[model samples]
Target: MSGWKEIILLEEKGISVDEFVSGFETPNKLILLEGCLDKWPTLKKLDRDYLVEVCGDNRFAVGPAQMTLTDYFVYSDQAQEERPLYLFDPKFANKRPDYRWIIIGPAGSGSSFHIDPNSTLAWNAVVKGSKKWVLFPPDVVPPGVYLSSNGAEVACPVSITEWFMNFYESTKTWKKKPIECVCKAGEVIFVPNGWWHLVINLEDSIAIRQNFVNRRNL
Candidate 1:
C-alpha cells in the first residue's frame, strides 16, 4: 500500500460557508463582503439608471451600488479607478484584512475566477444580479495560484494544501451543485481563508464586502 495514503482518509463533504469558517483552525481570511447593500442610502440610490450613468465610458462593469446577490461574478473593469487591487499589493492590506469586495455591474465590476491578495481567503456577495463561483484549495494548486499566460493553473510551491490537489470533481460539476446562495438585501456569508472563487453577474448587481480575520482566531 502507498505509505502516505495510510495516514489520511478523505471524503467529499458538503458544508455551508459559515460552517466551513467555524470548523477550520486557520483564521478565516475571507467573508461574504456585504456591507453597502445592507444599508438604506446605498439601496435607495442604486437603480438601473444610476448604474448606467456611473459606468459611463468604463462599461467594463456597472450596476446599482445597492442591488445584492448572494452569488458569484466574473472579472471586469470598464471603470476601475486603477488601484492596488489590480496590482495586488500585500503591503496595503489591513491588519485583519481577511476579506475584500468587488462592486459588480455598471459602476462596480465584472470579476472572474482568481485568488485574493497574498493568497489569502476571499468571498463575495452580489448586491444586484446573480453570479457564479468556483474554488480550489491551496493544495490543488501544485506550485501556486498565479495568473499566467496559460490560465488559472500554475507551478505552485510545496506549502500548498492537499485538498486542492486531491479534489477530483470537475469545476463544471461543482458549479452545477456549488453552494448556490442569494444574499438578498441583508443576508451575509463567510468564506474560509485560501479558498478559490469565481463570480459572474446575473443582472446589474451591486454589493459591498470586507476582509477580516476571524475574531476568535479559529
Candidate 2:
C-alpha cells in the first residue's frame, strides 16, 4: 500500500463524549478507538463456544437458507468456498431496531466496498479476533466499485479477497488514498456518513455494529 496512512487513533479514556461529538461534527473522518470496549462483559465472555451454548438453537438467515449457530460453525469450519458464509441476522433489526447487528464470520469472510444506508453514521465494535478495514471517503469511489446512474445499486468484485488481490494496490499510488487499519478485539471504528468501507476478518471474528442518525449528521 503506497499512500498507506492510518486513520486517526484515539484512546477511549483520552477523549470525552463531548469532545468526540465536537470533532465528529467537523472532520468527517474515520477514527479507530482503542480500548473502547475493554470493560464490556461481552469482550471477555463472548466467543464461538459461548454463543453456541446460548444461541445455538436460534436460526439465522445465511444467504438463502436459515442455519443455527452450531450448524453455521460446523459449516464455517469446513467451508472451502472463496467467500465463506457469514452470520448477519436481519431478524435482529426487528428485535432491537436501534442496534444494527451482531456479525460472526471466519477468516476469509467479509463485506466488500459499500456505504451505509440512509446516510447514517456507524460504529463497529470488535469483541473477538481482528479485522482489516479499508475505507474511502464519499467522493472517492473505490476503483473496482461501480454505482448505477441513479445511485441505487452498485457492482463490484464478487468477493472481498478478490478486490484486495486485484484493486488494492492501485489505491496506494493515488494522491488521496483510503484510510486503512487493522481493528483488533476491544476496539471500535467510527465511520462517518457516506464513507465507503470494506472489512475482512483476519481471524474468526465477532462484532457488533450500530448505525444512527444524530443532530450533527441530520
On lDDT, the leading prediction is 2
Which residue pairs in candidate 2 collide?
Answer: none
> Candidate 2's residue-wise lDDT over 1-218, tens digit each?
32344455778888998888877634666778898987787788998889899889899877668999899999988877888888887575456554488888999888889999887989899999899988888899999999899989988856887888889888889987888888899999898999999999999999989888888678
Candidate 2 worst ten-residue window by lDDT? 1-10
TM-score of each: 0.43, 0.93
The weakest ten consecutive residues by lDDT in model 1 span 1-10
lDDT of 1 by residue, 161-191 (tens): 2323443234335422333333443334445
Off by over 4 Å in 1: 1-41, 48-102, 106-109, 142-186, 215-218
Give the whole-model CA lDDT for all candidates, comma-separated.
Answer: 0.39, 0.84
Cα displacement (Å) at residue 6, model 1: 25
Query: Candidate 2: lDDT of 93?
Result: 48
Deviation in Å, model 2, residue 127 alpha carbon: 0.5
lDDT of 1 at 20: 48
